[model samples]
Target: MHSSAVFLIEFGAIILGLGLLGRIAGRLKFSPIPLYLLAGLAFGEGGLLPLGASEEFVAIGAEIGVILLLLMLGLEYTATDLVTNLRTQYPAGLVDAALNALPGAAMALLLGWGPVAAVVLAGVTWISSSGVIAKVLGDLGRLGNRETPVVLSILVLEDLAMAVYLPIVTALLAGVGLAAGSVTLAVALGVAGLVLFLAVRYGRLISRFVSSDDPEKLLLVVLGLTLLVAGLAQQLQVSAAVGAFLVGIALSGEVAEGAHNLLSPLRDLFAAVFFVFFGLHTDPASIPPVLLPALALAVVTAATKIATGYWAARRSGISVKGRWRAGGTLVARGEFSIVIAGLAVTAGIEPSLGPLATAYVLILVVLGPLTARYTEPLATRLSRLTRRHRPDTSAGDAPPALASEGPALTVDPDTAMSGSATHMTLPPSRGGS
Candidate 1:
């Protein structure tokens, strides 16, 4: 058999496997990431059918995947939504990312990994799976009113942060040591980004001129800008994902709709390829040894993030039930974790670390959705317990009712007492009633 034909056959098989597994996972109410990983394991190296794609090709495919994913992410933006909802959501996101990540990083260190590996792992676990959380909550119709804005804001914030976070992690892992040179390079990159922002901000005038004359031209311009920025960021040793995100943010302030439409096809194609390729790269056999540690880290990751979100929501004076629901909704990790894990591998971590990270992600993806499913019942019970154990209200007895001089308004009108009263009124009710 020709090598090209064999490669095509394997790739085709993997793609079909991904779609089938995704559908199966969805029907079973499980997160699809784990299933996708399984699909990869099934057809990838060391599996039933071994693949022959070079790591270099997979790496390039992954890069394209990140960009396209970011581009699609841009399409879901609304400034008014951000302004109205992100005020509180941003803080929760920051806290969730920080608190959840620190403990995970510490755990990684305790496991005898390098600091860079630990930080990378921490960042991966820190991010919540906004896509999954929103889908679950939206399906349940719980993502409305107060919870909607908070969750939306957090999702947007996480998306934006992933841009910066991806680059930082990549640099850290790529031997950009925590020395003065690295720090200087980082600062310079930041300044360049600021300059680019100012240029794009002012360039809106030019954009208006172009958009007014021709909408298609406007889209082309935005596309060019996105690629340019994304390319420049990569040139500067920053993550292209960060650059792509900035492109979205900048274009977000102007021509966002057009930018999204222009990027959509490209993004979709890349994203599909990314997920399928991601599956191909992961090997299930590599996950067994690290299963226990990954599980422990997954537990810590879920617990800390869930608690942080709950605490943050409670501080906002939300009911305990709301806190738990919101917390559970925020427990899932997202693409950022995979991106970080990839960086970790690129940065010279032990071969085992990549598979371990994959294992960690698979566990979280499974656990995250399950948490969403059971959150309501758990929250209801917890809230009930909290109410029952309150010091202000004694258990096993109803609190005293407020005394009223007037008759009570009961649903039953047969016992009503009224004298020339046109309104429907109920009779006087007893203390028990």
Candidate 2:
């Protein structure tokens, strides 16, 4: 068969599988990440077929996915949610990244990879699956809840850490050795990032000016700006994800309601193409020899994120059940990890590590949805344990099930920042870029 035709068949098959298996996973109470990963495996390297993947297409879709995902995330950033609660959340976000990154890197080193490959592996493992978290939260109808803002903020912080760390790591891989120049570049990027944050903070000028219901105008302007900024960031030797995220952040307010109309169609089409190409890249037969190591790495990656994220979430003052739910929700690795791993591969960081990274993501994606599918039941049990241990406490303090409505939004004299956009000024809640 012609490559193009085979590619289309594989793409169609994947989409079909995702939809069907997603429903199946829903019924089985399993997370969908594992399903997607399994789909990749079945259709990819070791499966019944291969598509001879195109790195370019997958990379682009992954890029846009991060942008759209983060754009939506940023719009949720009201003044109260982002600005007023930094002291605690910011530190906790750093801790979350550190806790995940350090252990994963150590594990990689134990596998005999040196510091550079280990670090790259660590970055690949460090990020949690934001897409899975968002899906489960929305399904539980908790996407708009107060805790969501906190979780979203932490995810944002992780992205920022990756944006900074990626360039430094890339430089090291290139034999730049983390010199003064790299440090200076990192600092400059931070300062520039702060400027971007400030613009998002007080500058409602763009949103107030060009906001519209026209999807074409919005997509062109919003996506064009994202691409431009992404290009600029690349010129500066920074991660393009940073630039794309900043563009999304700046346009968050203007695009929130109409975002689906503008980006969803294009996102769906392009993203499908992206995944198809991603599947085609691997020769599944080649993965057999490394499967054990990959599985081992994947297990460590999931455990580290769950344990550390749970600990960090708890320390951030979330309830025990909230912590477990958050940690479990984050257990999946998705497009972002794949993007970074692909980058590592392209840059020649280490030949073997690239497949290892891909294998790790595939494993996590397959397992994530299965875990998330049953999250509520598990959360209920955990919440019960907490309640039994302390019966006198109000239910309001604990994370409630999705079937229940949370405490009615109430005004607190001590904490007057209600759900208004003005209240969203909580210091760029936990985004990475």
Candidate 3:
């Protein structure tokens, strides 16, 4: 009885504090993620005031938070959309993985963390924070930009990749033998394929069965199904998050929208708790030793993400500025990074890995919004400065390819949002390079 009371009081205080922090973040037009982590640091082990009664509850909430995050991410697109993106934008996705995932893998191996840890860290660096990037796009009013589709395509590819990657990590972390691991991988892939097929073929029926005019019933049904499926997937070593994501993909139309609305608040609450939970496990003292490496990794990965985006946008014939904008927008790695690292932490892989990931995410998440806003302008300014210092060349000296570089085709946000952006093409220009 005494413990229950303490738990309630502590949990209530933490919730209230989170509310205040969230409001402050809203007013400042920044992500609350960093603030949440700082709060956790202050209230965690070896901090000013460590949490006792609510720590376990926070951990559970954190897991739910990840499930909900992936679920809603799945809800954003239909299975057909996924197939279309995979077919059309695969080159960009490949580039994205190569440029972004490699650095983290290299860093992990350099640190002598072995192959499993390397895979985990590679995922940590590979994915951009969909939540943060979405919010940033809306805030910056760049949702309609020509490059936004390119940005989102890369993100979608990453999310789809996670559906496979998480299961592999689970098998690795469990130290499963070759035959068992093969079975696990096969099951995961087969299940993913079956879900995608059913979703494409009969998504309407699935949504109709779950949907209700009553929002309360709708919410309960969808949430219940998601948890059930997630649990079963975990039992099969396929990853609960992936299962929740697949459930979401199977839901479409009005049902998906309704569930998303009903769960948004819960997602926000639990997601905040998730970030705090990650911070809690990480010793504040451990961060400094890893801070330099984290910063270096951040700098390198940021550049690679930018390059990936720029290359993708350019391939699609976007203007130079739009390419830069796309690149900058891809630089932030938030919840997903922590999610990947959290797996390694739970497996007790490397003590320093958690701190390194925490520091890396902290640096990037805060820097992400700033980059989304300024990278284009910064690049433009540098270009002008470089031009001013360079020797003047005659018109004929300019390369033909440079002269033909033209304005990119513009796409409405709705069109790109709908996955019809595969048809978008750039127009050739006879004007300036």
Candidate 4:
């Protein structure tokens, strides 16, 4: 009973602190994620003061946070949108995978963390934070831009990929045999296909069943259904987050919008807690040694994400500015990166992996918004500056006709009367002359 009091106090304080941090972030036009993570660090195991009473509860909340994150993400798109994005943007998805995934894998191998770790890290780097990117697109008033669709397409592909990737990672981290892993992978694929099929074929019916005139009942039903599916997905060696995502995709039209509206507050609260929970597990001291590598990895992957967005937007025939905007918008990796790292941390894959991911995410999540807001303008400014500073070789240099030894007489003063006849055909002069 006494311990319960402490848990309430600790948990209440966490909520209050997150609220304050979020308020400050809003005022300053910054991401509240870094602040939330820092708060967790201060109260984490190896930090200033760890909370024993609430750690277990925080862990549970963190899991729900991930489920809600994916669920809310799914609510944004219908099965048809996902299918459309996949069809037209698959090549871009391949480019995204190649450019972004390889760096994390190389870094993992360089750190001698082996193949499993490489795969985990590859995923960590490959996915951009949809939550963060959505906010960016909204905040920057680019939601309706031409390149927005391009960005969304790449993100959808990544999310769909996670439905497969997470299960493989789970099997790998669990040290399952090839047969077991194959089964797990196959099950994940089957479930994903089944969900999409149901969504596309009978989405209206599914939504009709969940739909409610009462917001409260609607909220409860959707949330309960998501949690149930997520739990089952976990039991089947698939990711709860993936299940939650599929649940989101299954709901369409007004049902999705209503659920999104109702669940958004909960999503924000739990998502913040989720970030904190991640930080609670990552030791602050472990970050310094890995800081340089994290910084380097962040820089490399930031560029790669930008490139992925740019290339995709270009392929979609977006203008140069829109391409730059798409690239910048994709630069931020937040919740999903931490989610991937948290799994590895839980499995005890590598001790330093958690801290490295923590530092890397801290850098990028904070930088993500700024990059999204500024990347296009900055790139344009740099290009203009470069052109301005470039050496003017044209100054005091020979004219085109005069520069060539093949011609001596250039413009005919008589022909110069007409603009089109300004330049006249000229014969070569004698070499001696």
Candidate 5:
């Protein structure tokens, strides 16, 4: 009875605190994720006042949080959308992997952790936070922008890549040999392909089976199915988050939409708990030791993410402003980065990985929204400044005869940079001879 009472009080207090933090962030026009993580750190093992009874329950809730996060992400699009993105946006995905992932791998190696740790850290840096990015887009009213689809396509590709990447990491962390790892990889691929096929071919039927007009029944059924599948996947040596995501993909139509609405509140609650759970495991004191490396990693990866986004958006023919916006939007790494690092930390890979990842994510999550809002204007200002200070090289060149006749031959930054214009007008040359 005493334990139950303690659990209730602690859990209730957590919920209440999260609500207040969320309200504060809303008022401040910012994300509450960093604040949520800080709260967890404060209440965790090394912090001010750690909870006794609720820690176990919070752990379970955190697992559920990860599953729900992946599941809801799946519901955002159809199987067709996934296929289309994989086919068309694969180059961007590859670029993203190369630019963002290599830095983490290099860092891990430089720290003398083995190849397995390198692979794990690679994933930690590769993925962007879809939840945070989506929220920012909605908050900033950028959903209708020309570059938004480009951003979403890249995000979807990354999520799909996780379906494959997570299983490999799981196998590596488990210390499986080549034959066993191959089998595991094969099974994971088969499962993923089969789920995609079913989702594409019979999604409506599957949704009908799971659907109910009654909200209570609907929530129970959906949540139960997700947990069951996730558990079984784990038992099969596959990642549970992948299983939950597959289940989400296999549902469509009104059922998908209904389940999404019913489960959103639950997702938010558990997701917050997951972030806190990550913080709980990380010792705040450990962070300061690795703070310099983490800060360096954050800075390097932020630039690479921006480059990846800029290249992808430019390839898609978005305007200059849209390209910068796309780059900046992909800068934040939140839940997934923590999830990857948590797996490594749990596997006893490296003591310092957790703290470094925590600090890195905290820095980027805070910087992400600000960059998304300001990157374009900043880039524009810098470009103008560069032009203003550039030395003139056309002093001896003759001005074009059409320059005076063609409205001064002004160039639109977007048109010129996007390569959409057929003709370029040389800047009116300085008079010579």
Candidate 6:
């Protein structure tokens, strides 16, 4: 009873604090994610205060947060959208992976963390925060922008890659041999393929099966199904997040819309907790020691992400401003980065990875929104300045003038009438005939 009382008080305070923080962020026109992380830091191991009873509960909530994050992301598009984006935007995805992931891998190797840590860090840098990006899009009213599809396509491909990447990382961290790892990878791919196929073919029927007029029933059914699939996927050495995402992809139409509306609040609540949980795991003192490296990684990856987005958007024929927005929007690395680092930290792969990731995410998450709002305009200003200073070769050149006698019309000679007025006269010819 005493423990229960303590749990209630602690959890209640945490939620209330989160709500207030969110309110403040909303008023200030800022993301509440960094604030949540700060709150967790304050309540975590080396901070001003720490909670004893509610930690475990918060941990569970954090896991749900991640599952729901991925689930809702999957709900945002249909199976056809996913397949089409993969087919058409795969080059962008590849460019994204190559540009953003390399710096982290190189840094890990420079830090002497070995091949495993390099791979883990590469994943950390590769994925952008879908939750954050989605929120930014809604906040800034960029959901309907020309470049938004390109952005979503890249994000979807990253999430899909995570479905495979997480399992492989898990096997590697566990020291599984080649044969065992291959089996794990194969299982993950097979399950993902099967779920995708079902979603594409029978999505409507599946939606009907889960659909309910009652919001309560709909909510319960969708949440229960997601948790069940996520659990089973985890049991099979695949990512629980992937399972939840696939479950989301399998539901469309009214069912998806209803589920999205019903689960959005829950998603927001759990997602906040997840960010806090990430902060809870890191010690404040450890961050300063790794702050330099984290800052360096953040800066390098930020530019690479911008390049990746610009290239992708340009390829898709998005305008200059839209391409800049796409690049800036992809700069924030949040949930997935933490998720990847959490796995490495849990496996004791690298002692410093956690703190570095914490600091890195903090820097980028704060910078992300700023960049998204300003990058395009800033680029435009710089471009104008460059053009102003550029030498004008065209100033010395003159355009050819047409004959002043009258307006001249050019016609194709191949289709012109033979010997019948090659060029029309302004006035009818007098006695020249």
Candidates 2 and 6: which is better by TM-score? 6
Residue-level lDDT tens digits of model 6 in 178-204: 998999999999998998899889988
**Winner by lDDT between candidate 5 and candidate 4:** 5
Give the Cα lDDT of each candidate. 0.64, 0.61, 0.89, 0.87, 0.87, 0.85
lDDT of 4 by residue, 93-132 (tens): 8999999999999999999999999999999998898777
* TM of each candidate vs. truth: 0.79, 0.73, 0.91, 0.89, 0.91, 0.90
The superposed Cα distance between candidate 6 and the true structure at residue 26, in angstroms, equals 0.9
Looking at candidate 6, what is the lDDT of residue 402? 37
User: Which should have the higher lDDT, number 2 or number 5?
Assistant: 5
Indicate the residue-level lDDT of 75 in model 4.
Answer: 85
Model 5, span 1-433: residue lDDT tens? 9999999999999999999999998899888899988988899878888878999999999999999988888777778788888888899999999999999999999989889989998998899998789889778867656677788888889999999999999999999999998988888999999999998999888999999999999999999999999999998899999999899888877888888989999999999999888888888988898899889999999999999999999999987888999999999999999989989888888888988888989999999998889998899999989987998687458567745565466554443343322222221100010
Model 6 misplacement above 4 A: 398-433
Alpha carbon deviation, residue 248, candidate 5 (Å): 1.0
lDDT of 2 by residue, 229-335 (tens): 77777667666666665554554454544654566656545544444444445556656666788788777666766675566666767665556656666678776
Candidate 1 lDDT over residue span 212-326, tens digit each: 3366777677666667777887777777776766555444334666656666656644555665566566676787888998888888888886787677767666665666766
lDDT of residue 140 for candidate 4: 73
Ranking by TM-score: 3, 5, 6, 4, 1, 2
